[model samples]
Target: MPTRRYDNSPGLGSLYARTVKATLRKAEYEPDTDGLTLELPRALVDQDHLTAYREVTGFSAGPALPVTYPHILAFPLHLDLMSDPSFPYKPMGIVHLANTITQLRPIPMHAELSIKVHSGPERPHPKGTVFDILSDVSVDGEVVWNDTTTLLSRSPGTPSAHADLLPDPCLEARAFWDLRANLGRRYAAASGDRNPIHLFKLSAQAFGFPRQIAHGMWAKAAALASIQRARALPDAFTVRVDFRKPLLLPSRVQFAHTITDAATDFAIYNDDTTITHLIGQLVAR
Candidate 1:
C-alpha cells in the first residue's frame, strides 16, 4: 500500500466539509484490491486535553493513557478514508459496530509517536457490508499499540445476532451514570471526535437519532476505567467491545462487570438493564 504522510493531524472542520460533499456526490462502493494508508510522522499529546479526556471518560490522572484513547488520533484518518471520493455511503451514516485494541507496551503522556491508519479488508455482513480499519502507533519503528475497528454500512438485508456477546444475567458489580445533556459536547472537545450527531440534538435528529448520543469510544473508555477502579488492568492487554446501540445523551445507564483471575467481562446498559448499549471483554496479555 502507498502511504500518505502528514506532519500534523488534519483539521476536522475541513474534513467534515469534505464529508458533506462526498455524501452529496456519493456512489456505490465497489470492492477493490487497492487499499489506502494515512500516516502521521510526528504526533504529540497535549496534556491539558489528555487530562480533560481522563475527566470525561473516568480514567485516573496518570501518565499512561487509557487503552482506548489512542483511537482519537486516528479519527481524522478514518473519516478521511470513508469520505474519500471512492467510498459509497455518507460518512455520517455509517455506524461503528465493534473495536479490538491491543497494547504491546505502556505509552507515556509525552512520548512522540508515529501513527498509521490503513483500510483493511471488506467482507459481507448479513445486513449490508462490513470493513476493518487497522491502526498502529509506533515510537521509532517499534510498535506500542494497535487496533482493528469494524464499521457497518446498513442496507436492506437479514438482521443477524451477536450470539457470542450475549449479556450475562448475573453481572454483580453495578453502577448507574446520570449523563448530562452536554456530555456529547464535553466529550467532543476532549476527544476531538466532533461528530455532529454526538454534539447536538438537532444535528442528531437530522441523522435519524432521537437525540445526541455518546461516542462509542468514550463509552468503552468509561467502562474500562470503571473496571480498573475495581481491579488493576495490566500494562499489556487486549480489550474488545461490540457497540449494541446508540446511548442517548442525558440518559441514565447501568454499567456492570465480572472479574476473574485471567480476564474481565463488562457491559453498559439502559438504567434498568433491559436494553444493552455495549458488551466487552478484556484479557491481559
Candidate 2:
C-alpha cells in the first residue's frame, strides 16, 4: 500500500469534527488488509507547545525533550488513520487500554525529526478486538523514539478475550494532587488530542461518561513528572502504563512507587478509596 504523506499536521479542530461525523455516520468501514503507514516531513518541536506541555505535566524544560513528546507529534496521524473510510472502527468509542514508550537515546531539542506511524491489524481480544498503533520518531535516519499504543473496541456479541484483572493497591501514596476539571482540556490543547470524551461534562455525557475524564496519557505524564522531580532517570529507558479506570475530572489522586535496581513500579489511585486508575513501570534501558 502507498504510504500517506502529509505536508503539515492536520489541525485538531478539523480532525475532531471529521472524526465525530465519521462516528455518527457509522459507515461500513473496513480495515486495511496490509495496514497503513503515515509519514510526515521533518519538523521542529514548537517552543510554545513544549512550554504548555511541561506546565501541564510538570516536566522540566531542558536540552532534551521528554520521552513521550513524540507521541503527541504522531497523534494526528493516529486520528487520520482511524477516521479513514477503510478503518474498521469509530474514533470515539475505542478505548486506549495501554501504552509503552521506549526512548533509544536522548533526543536533542534542536534535532529535526521525521515521524512515521503505522496502524496494525486487529487481533482477537477477550473483550472484543484490539489493535496496535505504532509510532517511531527518527533523527537523521536513526530511530530515537518508539511508542506502541493499544486500543480496544468492544463488540456486544463477541466473547471476552481474557479475564479482567485489577491491579493491587499500592502500600501507600508518596505524593498526592487534587486534579482540576479543566485538566483534560489543558492537556488536550497541548497534545492536540481533542477527543470529546475528555473535553467537558456535556461532551462526555454524550459518550456515556458521568463527567469529563482525564486523558490516560496525561495521567502517565504527570506520574513521570512527579517521579523525575524526586530523582534523575536514565537517559534510555522504557515506560509502560496500563490504564485501569477513568480518573474523573476535579478529583484527588495519590502517586505511589517502589524503586528497584532495574525498574520503578508505580501506581496512581483515588486518594479516598484506593481504587487503581493506572499501573505502570519505568525500566532502565
Candidate 3:
C-alpha cells in the first residue's frame, strides 16, 4: 500500500473535469489489489458548511456533528482516488451499492480531524466487480468515525465470497419528505458532490436517467434524521444501508422505520411503494 498526503484538499470542480476524461480514456477492469490510501492529516469543519448540511439533511443545529457529516469531509478523497491515473477503472459511472458507518463516538463541532480514504481489494459481485472505498476520521489520533462505501463496476458476473444480505425489514410510513428539484444542487453546494447525475436533468439524461436523482448519502442521512426526531441514536452505533433504487428529484417519498431493542430498521420508499429507495439497519455498537 502507498499513502498519499494532501497539503490542501483537491478541488471538486477540477476532479469532475478529470472524471469526463477518465470516462472517455479507458483503464484496466481488474481488481485493485495493490492498495492506495489518501490522507488529510489536518482538517477542520466549517460551521457554515455544516449548517448548510444540517438544513439539507434535516439534522439539527448542535455542537455534536451528525454521524454522516464526516462523509462529506471525506468525499473529495473518494473522487481523488478514483481520478488517480493508477486506479483500475474510470472515475465515472461506478454504482454505490451499499454503505456501512461505524460511529465510535459523537464528533464535536470544532474538533480537528485526521481523515483518511483508501481503496480496498476489489471483490466479486453478481453484476460485476465490487470494491470498498474506506474512509475514517480521527481526533487526536483516535478514530471516531469510519465508513465503507461498497461500489460496483458493472461487468460480467462472478461468484462472490460474501454472504447473503440481511432480510428486508417490514415497516410503515413514519413521515414524508417533499424533495424539491434543487435538492441535489443544494446538497452538492453543502457537500461538494457535484455529480452531474444528481445536479441536472439534462446531464442525468446523458447518463440514461430520466431525470436528476437524489444522492444516496442524502437519503441515508435524511432517514437517520427522521429517526432522531423520535429516538436519539446511541452514541456508538453502526448503520448499514443498501441503496436499492435511485430517487428521482422533485419527488414525494415515504419514510418508514421500526425501532427495536437491538436496532432500528428503516427505509425510504417511492410515494406509491413501487420502488424502495433504500433499506437500512442501525445498531448500537
Q: Pick the candidate with the highest TM-score.
A: 3
The TM-score measured for candidate 1 stands at 0.93
| Predicted structure 2: lDDT | 0.85
RMSD to truth, every model: 2.1, 1.9, 1.7
- Please tell me which model should have the higher TM-score, number 1 or number 3: 3
lDDT of 1 at 265: 89
* Tens digit per residue, CA lDDT, model 1, 54-81: 9999999877878888898878888887
* Model 1: lDDT to the true structure: 0.84
Per-residue lDDT for 1 in model 1?
66
Of candidates 2 and 1, the better by lDDT: 2
Each model's lDDT: 0.84, 0.85, 0.89
The positional error of residue 282 in candidate 2, measured at the CA in angstroms, is 1.1
Q: Model 3 reaches what TM-score against the true structure?
A: 0.95
Candidate 1: give the clashing pairs. none
The better candidate by lDDT, 1 or 3, is: 3
Count of clashing pairs, candidate 2: 5
lDDT of 3 by residue, 1-285 (tens): 788999888888898887777778866554356677999999998898899999999998877999999999999999988887777876688998999999999999999999999988877888887888999899999999999998988887576546236568888887888999999999899999988899999999999999999999999999999899888889999999999989999899999999999889999998977789999999998
TM-scores, all models, native as reference: 0.93, 0.94, 0.95
**Ordered list by TM-score, greatest first:** 3, 2, 1
Candidate 3 regions exceeding 4 Å error are 28-32, 159-164
